[model samples]
Target chain A: MIKIKLLFAIFALATAFASSAAADMAIIVNPNNAVTKVSSDEVKRLYMGKTKSLDDGTRLIPIDYVDGSAIKQEFYDKVVGKPLDRIKVYWSRLTFSGHGRPPETLSDSARIKAWVAGNSDAIGYIDTTLLDGSVRAVLIVK
Target chain B: MSRWRLPLLLSTALVGGGATAAELKWDGFFTSTYSITNTKSTYRDIVHDDGSFDDSRFGLHVVSDIHPLWRLEAQLFAAGYEDNYATRLDWGFASFHLSERLNLKFGKLKYPNNLVSEYYDVGLAYPWIRPPHEYYSLEEPSASITYESFSGASAIINRRSGDWDLVAQPFFGEVELAESDANISKFIGIKLSASNDLTELQASVAQGRINAEGHELDDQTKRIASLGMHTEWGSLVNYLEYAVTTFSDSEEARTKAGYITLGYHFGHTMPHITYAGFDQESGWGQQSVTVGVKQMLNPSTALKLEMQRITPQLNPEAGAEMASGLFMDVPEKTRVNAFSIAIDVVF
Candidate 1:
């Protein structure tokens, strides 16, 4: 009985790791754009509104997932150098001061993908599993 | 010959072509501040003499992107000063971007003598209830040492390492004094700033020379130097800055002073304490200490309560005479403790 219980525990742990691996996020852009790879610095500056245009002078429109979403946390942690809580406060100040506006928030990855595919100048990130051929993954945020 | 008219028309035509090709964008900010103070003596108070919102202000910052590499920006600031409305053009300039790391600026700057000087006018950008007067204090009542804040050319360069961010700037300009009789021409100066996230630590140093033309005696030449630092811990932010100023004529007349501020955030409220001091006739010297609490209603608005003690410890004679100098309006051997409450907002 003890041996059987041990095997079951191992199986559960393996499955959990697999689920975590399956949720990796990918940064996506419209397929029509010619640019491919983007440095982590560039991505952070774009999302933070520090840089108004891309390297090619193409106007950039960054989109965000729903607040507190796992993908949102992953992107901010790996790229933006700020946590969700700090970002919310930063956005509040910016919005209230009328200096700038936060990126549009989508309900889920499916909607984010759909919108990015439609807007040529738009950029967003979504789970790799939720991605289809409609939009191209420009760079993986890791 | 219409040679002058031809160039004028050609310039207009070129401008028209560019306007049609690029899109014009607009951006700005609106902000307000209120504060209240308490004093032991009602006769010598310097804070809110009336009630809350004693020093309320509003500003509009406008920017227009003309091209990928050029832009124009301006700011209009207004506040209630001396029981009435006072307004001024705070900042106006045009910038040309040579590259990502290098850019040239020609216009009026807020005398980038300190890191906080640029955004000191934007109250909402900082967590503190109010900007410490120690750093923002003016040498003259009209904010003119020379007719403008600092109108000239400036260059900024930055480089970031793993955990270090470095910024450097050099500028030259002239400031107009209150009388406008003498324009203080600022000599060349270089400022270096560096910060790190591990401690949110920032430090800066500046050195400059100023020359003002006066007919009575020799030109009053002055050398100015300052050092500043800011750091953050969990919910607390601390800042301290010291500046030393001396004149060419008086070797013993140099003055030195500094201020310290400690602020802690409690979700919605932040209580802070500040201490400012300087030596008198050091050409420029004063001492003041303020303690305050700020409650941020939201990201846009806040309320504050502050108390300050103003004393002239260096120049006993000037203190006695109420010399009417910058920050030396009170009599010597006397300290003014004031209490005040204020409300601030940005939109």
Candidate 2:
């Protein structure tokens, strides 16, 4: 009986950690956004400023939480095909020439959620647990 | 002293008030490079001799969104491209987006002359610390050098369909040439560019004439076409470009040039091979081949090594009193083999 009880506790703890790790990342878009889904590749292009519009020609404006955020790094590795250093150099080259600007940066997930919720054209990443009726969750990054 | 005082005062105020004041966001970059070659040329003295950071640079940039549709930006760059100390204005522009497909820009613009012209201006932006100096030769090549930077208005248009993307741009501007008031008359040019997941192609044509001291030298015309392909299998990037130019004067002169490069990446290191040739109306032509290697130590840093064999060709003159003038008093042929090492960094 004790062995079974201990096994149950261990399983519960592992499940909790897994859930928290997945919930730590949430792909967010404005409430009015009609897009229901996004592929990992598309998300990468959008955040990198490579593609300016969605499939339906809806203009996209991307935002970021901060430079070194875990979600940001995850998004880059999954989509951007480059590490932080390469992204920095890429942005440095583009921004210095006035060709493009890096995405707007917020302090934390709360601010990211708030910005995406208020702007109809904005998209960002946030903690899934913090999402509510104010915004729409489009995708979940594993 | 006065310029330094302002920063000092601002820091004092921030410390005394203990106010975060919106948490100033910062972004910037810095780079250093070194080059070496055995080409017996005067321009060699101006570039890196070996593995040393002679042509170094550092820059800072910042931008703030004043509104949803508007933003303000500025950048300052300091480099040793020509000498030990020289600061220049890289870009200061105001852009007003008219629509999703169209936008208007007014300010100092980096003119699109060649494939790598804009990024090559900054050392750290490319795998090579110094662009092929023989091709992007700074001073002696009057036409290619002056077209690197300009001031004027530009329009950019882009459209995408499936896995294919298309972009087109046409601009009109006059470039600053030398200290003289010699301004290139209005130039109208257009570029057609297309890209898929693995391959990309671009072609451009521009025409204009130069007016120096009210002396019309000739009507200047330029056309360049290039194709680039990158495949996923080996992470290979290969490109080739051809440029033809014609100048009108009391006598008409034409020049033609082309370059091809194939690069493959192996984890962090990429090795490439290059072949290029160019010809001038002055009976001067050159052909060379190079083998090079580049490594990305990190995202913001890279190192490169290259060795090349260059041969300058001299054509024979008509009605000359020499035998096979092509192999005349030019010691039959002048061959130069050069090796170079470079480092690039961004912060």
Candidate 3:
């Protein structure tokens, strides 16, 4: 009976660690903005520069985290559904062709959240653990 | 002012004064390649028995957003194509956002002929060190209707339907072909494309009057049509394009070119193969097979190695005069092999 109890405790600990490791990401905008919800496809399109405006005709300024950030990689992998290398190539094509530009990158998630909170037209993604009333979460990326 | 002086001054001024009233962004790309072919004759003026670095090039792109409705963009480029790397203005344009779905651009614009025409010089954007010559070479003897850029205006229209984003571009322009002393006037074209997350389909049609000096192509009406598709299925990627050009009065100049490329990704490395063909109505033709691999060193840099085998088609009964195929100064029918190594980077 003691062996089974110990095994159960170990399994519970592993589950807790896994859940924390796979933390959720939140797509955030200024709390004053009218938008309350956004689809994954819309976020993808906005971040990719395929669309420049929101559904209600508000021009959007998408922001990104700096290169080599672990959260940046996770956001692209989970939300954008494209490998980071492919995204780089796609932006290269657009930038060189004068078609579009990628989002300007900030240093960290705190700055991204702060920027989103300050600008009504800005949108950014951050770890859900960093969420607060300063910004509104439009989409929760799993 | 010299050709290089204006863009340099403009760039300096813009960058220096970028702190106020406008959002300025700067980006650049570079490619350096060494290529050699097993032949005495030069192919594309760069590849021959003696290796050359003439394929290397660099470009700097700048974009200034002055307002919600106005933007300015320019690209300064330098290349080693027999000119000793002279800097020049590749394209400079102003874009006007008229509405949520429409934009107008005026200036020097990249030729909108094929799928890769706009970003062809940026090797990091594609899997090949060089795009297949059979379809991408503008100086190919059989079909030389395309130009690098035109001075004019273009409009972009956008729409969305279900999961696809649709774009339509209509443009009119005039261009001078420096290589052959040709002038294209009254040029008009339209390109339509639909794309989603994993696929894109494109079609375009262009018409122009061509006048080449001291050549048989004088005073000809040229019409070109092309179809292209680029798709990715998980780790598998495919690109296919077919184009045809018809000269109103020169039957022998009617040409068709096509290529299909298949590539599979293995982590950070991809190996690709392509089969390309170019043919004229008078039975002059060439076909090539290219095999290459691209390795991503990082997010913004790539290294590529490629080998190609080109076979020239000669038809004496069809009254074809030259067996040079795409190579220069070849007198007899023969196959040529080429090898190239390149590094591409963007920042």
Candidate 4:
């Protein structure tokens, strides 16, 4: 019975870990865009609104998932290098300074995929399981 | 040909609004602080017994993205907690983005000297209920020395080079001092700022000709300069600021000031200590030590509680007759201890 209980605990922990696997995250861009891969620093800069355009002088529109999901946390932690709340503060200061805006929010991954697919300048991230030819994953950090 | 740029941009903005889409975005912040000082005499800018909310303020910031390259920004700030609070146009400016790294702006803008210098009024952005008085004080009434802002033209350059991000701004402007009924002109300044992921630093120098008529002060040449730095290590944050100002036409000239803050964050709570002081060549010096705790109520709001011990030093033997900055316009010279609780919100 003890062995069975230990196995149950291991399963629960594995399930929790699997829910937020960074490997599942893929930074996706519109397939029509020429950019192939994005560096981690570039990703950080774009999301943080430091660089308004890509290195090649192309304008960028970054999108975010609205829900407080593990995927959102993983993106901020691994890519932006800050927690979700701190990012909110950062965006608040920037918005108050009239310097930048937070990324437009979509309700879920399907909407993100649809939105990025339509706009050539748009960038969004999603679960690798949702990857399709409709969107090109430019950088996979996880 | 260059003179037509202003009218051309204005017409473009108006026509562009009718033709293509233009975006108007706004953000706001509110801060309420209740403070009481122990001194019996009433200080000009101090809140004594009753919760005057002298430093409490509400701000609304707006940005109009008329074009990809042209944008207009403004901020309306209101102070005090009374229902009849007065509002002021703290910033109303237009920015023309020359490129991804360069931009030009005109109108009234924050005179950026340090990290908190530009946004000291925005409480939601900083941990303190109020910034250290030594460095970013209101410069008026022969008191507050940090001139918050000026009106004129400025060039902004932002570049990211490897690990260091560089920001350089050259500005020339004039400031109107209402407290003393004065106006400063021919103000030219250059500020250089750099930051990495963990730390940021700034240095600035400026000189302006001042014209004033109030309380035995007038026609002064003002020179101001400052250096500041901020660093963060995990949950620990540190801030240091040093500034100096001199008046060639006044007796109480040459004021030197600095402040240091050390804080540690534990989850939503931050406990910190701060020491700030200023010494005027006129023989009056003042210093204060503050201990505070900041608690984030949510992503958009925070609560801060702090206490401070203020000490004023006036030396008659130094052959100076007056005090500047906070030491001015006080009924009597005395020490004071003060406490404040503030709530800040960003929306």
Q: Which ten residues in a row have the lowest lDDT in candidate 3 chain A?
A: A51-60
Model 2 Cα lDDT, one tens digit per residue, B1-347: 13234234433443343333323334566655554445333223443223335556776665544434444444556666544545545554556666666767665566655556555555555545555543554422222534335667778787777777787878777666634666666766766677655666777766666666554353443333333332333367676667665564422235566677778767677788888776667565667788888887776667777786667565443223231111222322266565666666655
TM-score of each: 0.72, 0.75, 0.93, 0.88
lDDT of 3 by residue, A67-134 (tens): 89988888888888877888899999999999999999999998999999999989999888899999
Question: How displaced is residue B110 in candidate 2, in Å?
Answer: 1.2
Between candidates 1 and 3, name the one with more favorable lDDT. 3
- How does candidate 2 score on lDDT? 0.61
Please give the CA lDDT of all the candidate structures.
0.59, 0.61, 0.84, 0.75
Q: Candidate 1: misplaced stretches above 4 Å?
A: A1-26, A32-42, A49-122, A125-130, A138-142, B1-17, B20-31, B34-48, B51-54, B140-148, B177-179, B198-218, B251-253, B281-286, B312-328, B331-333
Ranking by lDDT: 3, 4, 2, 1
| Top lDDT hit | 3
Candidate 4 wrongly placed segments (more than 4 Å): A1-17, A20-23, A66-70, B1-16, B43-46, B81-84, B140-148, B214-217, B250-252, B314-333
Q: What does DockQ give for each predicted structure?
A: 0.18, 0.35, 0.81, 0.53
Docking class of 4: medium
Clash counts per candidate, in order, are 24, 1, 0, 3
In order, the B-chain TM-scores come to: 0.77, 0.76, 0.92, 0.87
Name the best candidate (by DockQ).
3
Candidate fnat values, all = 0.06, 0.50, 0.74, 0.41
Cα misplacement distance, residue A124 of candidate 4 (Å): 1.6
lDDT of 4 at B102: 93
lDDT string, candidate 1, B103-134, tens digits: 66766555665545665545555545455554
**Candidate 3 off by > 4 Å:** A1-22, B1-20, B140-144, B179-181, B314-323, B331-333
RMSD of each: 6.9, 7.3, 2.7, 4.5
lDDT of 3 at B220: 80
